[model samples]
Target: MTTIARSEVLLCEARFYAFHGVMPQERKVGAEYTVSVTVGYDYAKAAESDEVDDTLNYAELYELVKHEMQQPSKLLEHVALRMGEAIFQKWSQAAYADIRVMKNNPPMGAACAGAGVNLHLVNDKTKKC
Candidate 1:
């Protein structure tokens, strides 16, 4: 039997300040956001080669996330989903991507920590294989 080895690269709690919300104050004053991303890919080549080129570069991933975050979106869910899709589009070798976006101290008229959304996407090619 042939077994496929898989591994994950994660960027956790990447913080950002941006204007994204339905509320007027939120759009004007802006808010802090926390984003996390996980990307899954085959481990064999990178493990054996021990070379940066053999694997997904984390810096590039961060850049992609940052670019997506800069675009204003009313919903965290939209942001998260777009990030996941963008990751897959950039890294064709990636098997899966999971993205999360969080808004801190939202104005809900109560003591609420935050609101967030998570999105998980699988590569179409990976699904076929």
Candidate 2:
């Protein structure tokens, strides 16, 4: 008999400075942003194989997020969604992904830590087009 295992890879609180807002100053001056990503996958092989190739490469994941952040967007939702899609497209083993994008000290006339969007995506291999 064999047992199945479920696991997740997380890239948390990655900080970046980029242009990602709907204002002129935001695009010109850029702002501090934080991005977090969670990817669901089965890591049972890597746990035993002890090989980096057996599991999702977190460094690569960071690169994906960094690439998406470089492309300026007017909405955090757009950024988050793109990140999620990139993860799924790159790694077919990914079952699902949760992405969060936050902008620190938003210009919305309020004293707050940050404001942004969270996006969840599922890979439906059985879904027919």
Candidate 3:
């Protein structure tokens, strides 16, 4: 029997200040945002070889997220979707991507820590396999 191995690399609580909201003030002043990303891939070779090249480079992943954050979006969903698409585009080895973007202390009159969006996507190539 053949067994499939799955592994994930996570980048958590990455904070950024970006313009992403429906309000004009938000676009001008920007807001604090927290982003988290999870990438699923086959790390069997890395586990055995103990080489960075054999696995996904998390630093690169952060760069991708940072790039997306720099672009102004009206909704958190758009930010998260772009981040996920960027991941799959750069790393074909990635089987799936889970992304979350949070806006702190939103304008809405509510007693809450934050509001945000979560996006999960599976690679089309991986589905074929």
Candidate 4:
């Protein structure tokens, strides 16, 4: 006999600091970054046991994101997309992941004000979708 359960994890607007930009000036001058992450997976079995270890620990997840955010990148999109990959690597059971990284007061050179990027990724372990 096997018991099953599922849980959807949603973390909206998780804030952090990242040095990501195309120009050297931008990288040298860091900016405030906002991260929105969502991870979904099957936690049926973990739920049944009523154990904290059975389900995804948000604390650990946050740590991983924070670490990735510190890594400098050329583009926010790259940061966002890679963040999804990091999450998947940390949690193999995660089926769906969406990431959004926002840079406050971006250096647009008058072309634009603030700019950011978003990315959505899905684990292809089972090809569920």
TM-score of each candidate?
Answer: 0.89, 0.92, 0.93, 0.83
Candidate 3 displacement at residue 9 in angstroms: 0.5
Model 1 worst lDDT window (10 residues): 1-10
Clash counts for all predictions: 0, 0, 0, 2
Could you arrange the candidates by lDDT from highest to lowest? 3, 2, 1, 4
RMSD of each: 2.4, 2.6, 2.2, 3.3
Residue lDDT tens for model 3, 56-123: 88998999999999999999998998898889899887889989899999889998889999888999
What overall lDDT goes with each candidate model? 0.84, 0.89, 0.90, 0.78
User: Per-residue alpha-carbon lDDT of model 4 for 63-97, expressed as tens digits?
Assistant: 88898898899988777777788888888878888
Between which residue pairs do clashes occur in model 2? none
Candidate 2 lDDT tens digits, 5-120: 55899999999999989998898899999999999988889888999999999999999999999999998999998898788888877888989899999989999999999888
Output the number of the lDDT-best candidate.
3
Prediction 3 TM-score vs. true? 0.93
lDDT of 1 by residue, 10-117 (tens): 899999998888877787788999999989977667777999888888889999999988888888888888888888888888888888898988788767777888
TM-score order of candidates, top first? 3, 2, 1, 4
Per-residue lDDT value at 78 in model 3: 89
Give the least accurate 10-residue stretch of model 4, judged by summed lDDT: 2-11
